[model samples]
Target: MTTPATIPTAGDEKLPQAAKQSGQALQTAGRHTTQEILTFTIGKEAYGLDLLTVREIRAWTDVTPLPNTPPFVRGVINLRGAVVPIFDLRVRLGADATEPTNANVVIVVEIGDQLCGLLVDTVSDILALSDDAMQPVPATAADADHNFLSALATHEDRMVALIDVARLFNRGVPQVSEAA
Candidate 1:
């Protein structure tokens, strides 16, 4: 039998003003309009990305290791004949890496013209949040790991870190060989 999909639990964080107003509008109209977000888990926290940007989610597959590659770069996988680099989300989040389990999933996403797979602990369900559900990233967030986040979304009690796909490979990380 196939495994059941995981869905994120809404938390208590307050929504941003814009999202609040939008939520209010939807509530009054008896309808809600929300953007679909593909949520996932990294370390102990929840994160999400725009579903439109996600191409596919695959189970953990054998990665072709590259010499001199950074530890976070789990290596590349032949995704339908096209080699796509995969990065371990745990390492990228400054967490200790763990062995992949049945719950692990590789989230393949396209940012601009570059395609990359994010190795996450598990794939959560698609979150549909009204405009008011999103919140602004705090100033302190700028001081955190540069590549750790790009945006923030609040749902009741939890804050979801929006991955910045473009900056996933920061300056400190070894660049993938163009010749590959």
Candidate 2:
């Protein structure tokens, strides 16, 4: 049996004092709800995704470019005999295309029945954040780009924008990949 003290977490040390106290109380009873997020950086911004959606993280490798594909679709790579399309997240998020390098990585994630890779500058850290730390996306930004993000979480005095992969890539979309 795992005791509260035995359970490890990164957010426990960075939570607000009061929230930390409350978290400890909940932890003691083994009832704490910690949201695990996979954080990564694109250019200068921090972004996060639900850890549950992530399948695996792979080092950047050359992909076979697909003709007629959108700019964001950098092409696909064969993962264990399965062809997975790689999307340049920086470009998809309205930034310039990322110049692939050794520092870059592909975050393989499953959305619905589709498995795809998100090309990011670097894989930051997997953080366990409390629900209270997550705030709704700004009203103006949400209204303008409703599907782009789910929420904004504050950790270590930094804001990590939570990417809503499902909404961002809309189900059964040709722009993301071919029907599979």
Candidate 3:
């Protein structure tokens, strides 16, 4: 079983603290800002998110489906008592749905004040890249998937689409603010 000590959540400040200890320098000598990205796979394509926003990684677990939600929304999972909505990355990107397998993983992240989970095929690398290494998303590729990408970064000769977490979910992750 995975222990809490091994996994870092937003409540556990250890992650950012340890990261700061190692990456004390956020900027390079030439005034270039360095950013850390957590890359993962939806299918064959690669995607990434800001490392600072990632909370924890969980093995694929059965989620309780909700009614009247989009197909992309796989459902919600209770994480330490909080209901975190999980979205299937493949379906969200206009691809076929994913069949849950032992190899799948759920990446919990903070979209704002709420916590949400992104269901992905596999977790890849944690890359620290400079701002200049990232290229802006070309306007020509505008679409549902394209709109979600803020930048395209290359690492080890592979292009990783950096997702704009905030821009996803036009209505935001469904949070139960009050009794409906």
| C-alpha lDDT score of every prediction, in listed order | 0.73, 0.80, 0.80
Q: Pick the candidate with the highest TM-score.
A: 3
**Cα-based TM-score, every candidate:** 0.73, 0.77, 0.81
Candidate 2: where are CA atoms >4 Å away?
Answer: 1-32, 141-146, 171-180
lDDT for model 2: 0.80
Q: What is the lDDT of residue 167 in candidate 2?
A: 79
Q: How accurate is candidate 1 locally (lDDT)?
A: 0.73
Clashes of each: 8, 0, 0
Model 3 bad stretches (over 4 Å): 1-25, 177-180
lDDT of 1 by residue, 1-180 (tens): 999987432234444443464232222233344667889988679998878779999999878887887778888987776678888988876778758887889999886666788899888788777666766666775455664465688877888887767676654454444456
Who is ahead in TM-score, 1 or 2?
Answer: 2
TM-score of 1: 0.73
What lDDT tens digits, residue by residue, belong to model 3 across residues 77-125?
8888788899998888888999999999999988778788899999998
